[model samples]
Target: MSEAADQHANAHTFIGAIDQGTTSSRFLIFNSLGEVVVTHQLEFKQIYPQSGWHEHDPNDLVNSVTTCIDGAIEAFERQGHSAKDIKAVGITNQRETTLVWDVRTGEPLYNAIVWTDMRSAELVRNLKKRLGASEINQLCGLPLSTYPSGAKLLWLLENVPKVKEAYEQGNLAFGTVDTWLVYKLNGGARANVFVTDPSNASRTLFMNISSLTYDEQLLDFLRIDRKKIHLPEIVQSSHATAYGSLAVSKLRGTPITGCLGDQSAALVGQKGFTPGLAKNTYGTGCFLLYNCGPKPVISKHGLLTTVAFDFGPGKRMYALEGSIAVAGSSVKFLVDNLGFIKSSSAISALAETVEDNGGVCFVTAFSGLFAPYWVDDARGTIFGITAYTQRGHIARATLEATCFQTKAILDAMEKDSGHKLTELRVDGGMCNSDLTMQIQSDLIGIPVNRPAMRETTALGAAIAAGLAVGVWDSFDDVKNVNTEGSTIFKPLVHEKESAVQFARWEKAVQMSKGWLA
Candidate 1:
């Protein structure tokens, strides 16, 4: 493959991509042209104590990244490729989630406030009521709901004395997962590049949509003392003078080149370089992002304006994102929590065993809802369950969770962009389930295209770095080395079937509303 021109395809240089996601950490090696030569993945812990709260040990994230790096080098050696050939590294991570850590000791001051955590639900509602929804929506390209990081950060400062004290003493540094990884990967507070990009920073609720930088007004509104806290310097997502080098690895001196929130990275990996190009990633959660060129579109519906990634010296590209808080997480709920399924792969078989949901619909508001409806009080409400319902029916409904959520988000994006998407480019762990893909296609009444490698997140980061370093010039040059996998799911069910299913889901949504009261 000529992903990049052959001039840069010689054996001396390769790119390493570290894709740190919500549930796992992975290291992938890409050749000069833009191909995944080797990859290693490790899943981490997800802690759920009280309802609407989620947590992750920051050390686990560090360990997982290190392990994947080492394991991937070993895999590369087995494949007869030299890990030393690596010239740079690209990092893609889950965004909006906040991490507050000690600037001196390098230890996380608190468990990471995961993006899915809804502890700030009340604060969000209060803020929305205080600041009109129309103003909040138009200004931030988002709704005044619980899904943002600003309210979560405020809750921590008021409640966690340790974090507040650290902030008061000017020893606190806050960041999303990307900043956390770059810190730990390069030696934490001692020897790391503690910086983030517009792509990730835009979601923090601190950044101004127009300036693409943190705003003074929002800071005042949040009452954050700039002198007491450390905010990572925002930079281009594709360059950072290389994040030092990785120790205890074969790919030492490999410049860390790219950084994007996972969803935006997926858009890059899917080659969504133009307007109207969109991708839906079905991971622990499902996220739909539509590229809206360089200009950001504030949403009338519940959508977030985000930077896809600033390529280089050019203006940062903007996108409208609709996030589904629970997609594959529903499957995890079934297998790991409910004990209804033994393995994740079994979910597809279980879902296929039933022709339909059999009057069952699981809202998975287990935490709350996201996208079009930011209902935080809503809890998981599985309705229309009849005596004949079995695991198969529940399994089908679980798969439907992704389909229904995707449909809602697509509608929101459509309203925001004033353009109807022709088809959806799908990737992530859940897209492997053919049944889910079919359901997604039927619900949208369009074709769903799945890439061959399915590791678009990692690949996206790689492309970002590759482009920045001239490993590839222009998006078209990457096509040669780009290897695409295909599995297109076309709508099979009738239009009325889709309408019927949507109505049932809407009722469940209504029943689950006003949960906080």
Candidate 2:
């Protein structure tokens, strides 16, 4: 064989990951070594029809994913690799973003209700007063809040005319982003491959977390007629033929073998397979997930119990999750809404210009506070602002808001799990800011470890896909993946000082309550 042919024969096989998030859709191809080979990302429009309402055109999602896959495959071919060199693809998406479409036409009945949207607040409030309301969290591992897809679906069925009509006609199909992506990528109505994994299903409040299936009592309590709407079949997170294949693209016919919610994918990407391991992802929203072994731990605090992942029957794990409703989006608010800087990347620079928060503390409850608080009545409140406050002060306070919430979550996790995390594995956009991370480490009083490869979320989906297709035999086989070039930020302030700072944040949180009331 010629040298070119020899090189081609020795080329590495790759796995592609579709990371559909709140703000963007991304496709990343990774080699067996967990190193990124080629990647493409596309940001789509974020629609806010009114205050506390967020929606995404369903077409934007599918189109962005299709474009990203095509773009990444083109780049992969430009290298010495062929499209055939790519094996199965995986999907990780923003959980609880609800959608309903016609079962026959495959057209969306309404815009995708974003996971952070609060239009269902009134519905959720009434749900808490209904019979069997107290059993919801125990059965589904989620509280009756606007955060779950079931509440969103209920709101749509009651409010949207088209959605109501579809439900009454028995043509409504309910799904999170994962199920929709799978259905569309596999030829939509032609293939009709509608399924979701346990991680995604657990967030819907429609699935029984223990049995990993749809619960009758939950449906009855929510007043959803099971016969009226079609829910996606729950499947394993890693499987060979469950998710089907891409129907049109350069990589058409590639099987989708793995699926996870974005935060669960990050945990897997960080190699947090063992109990007591934890990871925090600083995305559009901040999420801290601590592994809690096979069985779920119902939280006494406001933390949520959820399925971490389900590789197969004996390979499932659970997590205690603390979700912050705002993180990187808060930074975006400064850049776009307040014009504090040119872009999000400039936040750390602007914050570093100030020595401290200058007595300002921003409670970022634009929608409401989530996790350990669940204070739906609170609005975004800034405390201690005076004539001395500058843009830098506000910027620092904005960054501190996320850190403070993270600290509260960690404390709650410790109380629920009876285990203190030694260090935190961190990834996502906000983790790129060294100053913010240092502040996080100081307030949390633990090391914040960030890998050089920050796309752990995508890598996680790739890992799941690769596992099903024999790229790696077991979890142990991939232990060394993505373990190099890590930066660890440790505490620099005294313990007393950190406690005082957190106390002030708690005071601000308490004071921020009742604005929505």
Across 463-484, the per-residue lDDT of candidate 2 in tens digits comes to: 9999999988899977888899
Q: lDDT: which candidate is best?
A: 2
Tell me how candidate 2 scores on lDDT: 0.94
Clash totals for all candidate models: 5, 0
Instruction: Provide the global lDDT of candidate 1 against the true structure.
Output: 0.82
For each candidate in the order shown, give its overall lDDT on alpha carbons.
Answer: 0.82, 0.94
Q: What's the C-alpha lDDT at position 377 in model 2?
A: 84
Listed in order, each prediction's TM-score against the native is 0.95, 0.98
Position 261, candidate 2: lDDT = 98
Worst 10 residues of 1 by lDDT: 3-12
Query: What's the CA RMSD of model 1 in angstroms?
Result: 2.3
After superposition on all C-alphas, the RMSD of every candidate to the true structure, in Å, is 2.3, 2.4
Model 2: residues with Cα > 4 Å off, grouped in runs: 1-11
